[model samples]
Target: MKKFLLSILMGCSLLEAAAQTAFTVNHGPYLQEVTQDGATIVFTTSRKAFSWVELKQHDAPEAEAVKHFNSKDGLKEAWNTFSLVRVEHLKPGTSYDYRIISKEMRSFQPYKVVYGDSIATKWHTFSTIDPQKRGGSFFITSDMHFDAAKLEKLLHAADYRTCDAFFYAGDMTSYIDKFEIPFTSFIDTSVKLFASSVPFEVVRGNHETRGNLARTYSSYFPKKNGKIYGSCLLGDVMVVMLDSGEDKAENHWVYAGLNDYDAYRTEQAEWLKELMNTKEYKKAKYRIVISHFPMVMSQQWKDEKEWVGWEDAIRKFLPVLNKGNVDLLVSGHTHRYFFHEQNVDGNNFPVLEQGESSAVRLELHGGKVQFQVIGVDGKILMEKTISKK
Candidate 1:
């Protein structure tokens, strides 16, 4: 009897050991908010663990690699399954190899912390955006609405690998109901295809604002300003991303008094007014604004009742964009494709509304800006070039 009890005890210990060894990466090691001198790397582990990123120039020796972590008040963030490490002071347009390392935390007691086995990912490569470069390309699409298969088809329709970045105008999912919704819907495929190497920029849409996890969206896609709307300079071209909150008014019955997008639009307008005065905005060879909701609607929908959000955007954002001399505005909320000429519906710049089944590849080179709308079937649906304003 004593010998049998000893064997059972030993088996239990072995199982516990095996559990600790099972800790591994669960989701991403994808790039975000990549700029000339910095980038944010985000990923998740299967279990609670402390994580960091180690990187070096692509051709540099491994000995020269440096580690980075998300730190606050001189303390590194740990004991969390989600990891977002920001790396800075990188050279512009330079290539680097990076990997994620995590050490599982077994227990946490005052003065008695226990740690488990560690794991690291194989190296991945990326290049920082260069402000001086005169040419580049990026992919833009929207209204995916949780169709992972459709997202994959759209991505495959373009030469996404050669693009500098990927932009999802919004509605990647129907709603953020669960923690895994983003991964299961679109992010996992993005990381598999090109997001690990190229930056992924997302503009929040109306659908993304629903459900419980919606409030935590920024944790997954952290920006320097902590807001969904911002601007990035890619070479001589400036891309402005605007967050056009929910489609209904703050007091609408559907919102249940939890939204204040009207005020948010006013706030964003203030920021846009200031951005237009900056030298970077004035000097860029081309300026493109991306908003998930189109500032102007077709004549038929102009009088619709639930268009408070659209009306607010036009009243607040359109004036600023007009004065900024923006060359193009790309939007996708209606899921309908149309190209509105300049001065249509009070917008000084042209508007291109991307449909649910199409993606746009925008290329900038040698003082020319051109875009081609490609359908999920890999055929060019429409093509146009914009002359400098």
Candidate 2:
């Protein structure tokens, strides 16, 4: 009898091990859209599994654990690989640790179901934005164009030792090709870096709107209100993120009658105008606009272009933005770095861009915002300081 019991126990142990190994984290645990009161965690699984995030205050007792499930927030009960869990009502500017929990689904059908053993990821901690904090820092890079090695190298050299959040101005991938290798490569690299910790803010580039998979961009990285442009508060500064549609005319032959950016940009410009009048914009100590393309660029082509790409953008948005007294505009699209001082773009703010091989690090504190353009070799290419006006 004892020998038979031992054999049964060993069989069960082997089965559990196999089940655990079958379901693995395919990507992420990456942080997204984190605010003072809430945050969203995104991850993918190797197999279709029911997943959730078990989180708690970093300093809370173990017994006070909170289970954040996607289903409770209107997500379906179907077996899906990707999981997005939004944890809400969290205390502002607080530290918390969380782990990804998943159960492998062998079969899912009406009235009959089969599930494997459950597994959990190792705990990772992150802090929400602190509204009252007077000092903080962030990192920004752009125009990666699907270069993972360059992405990894620039981030590694920057170190992110004191970064509160990370931003990709645009063009992380050349095109959204069915969420295939190119898209996954860009996301995987980002997940490896700040996914476990800081917030990952991404802006859409012109290239991202191309290919058959272009429309799927938001299904991966969703924006508030389902619009590509929105604003968020990072401490005392309000970061305005915009989507500059294709860098060419809507009626251009290359668009194949698929692009309608001129009207979209006009809609966004109207939204910006309304947003500028809000108390949130007026109360913030700093206002910064982040977009993929700049309103001003000196490089002009002699192709006798009838519909220049930026012409509509400048006509529709610059007038409203200039009236709002924007303190700074950070952008990337040309793949070449440059800083246009105040009034250079018919706007009162300075515009800065981080080129293909460099990253921008900004330190916000003591009434001044200090930024440095650091190359992949860990050398500072340019340094600029802006103070609160």
Measured over all alpha carbons after superposition, the RMSD of each candidate to the real structure, in angstroms, is 3.7, 5.1
lDDT tens per residue, model 2, 259-367: 8888889889989999999998888887888888887666463244644666777678788888877877888987878898888658677888778889988877777
C-alpha lDDT of residue 216 in model 1: 88
Q: Largest TM-score belongs to which candidate?
A: 1
Q: List the residue pairs that clash in candidate 2.
A: 30-195
lDDT score at residue 28, model 2, on the 0-100 scale: 83
Model 2 alpha-carbon drift over 4 Å, by segment:
1-21, 72-76, 180-183, 299-307
lDDT of each residue in 107-195, candidate 1, tens digit only: 97889879997999989999998777886787999999999898889888987777877899999888897999988888899999988
State every prediction's TM-score relative to the real structure: 0.93, 0.90
Instruction: Show how many residue pairs clash in every candidate, following the order shown.
Output: 0, 1
Clashes by residue pair, model 1 = none
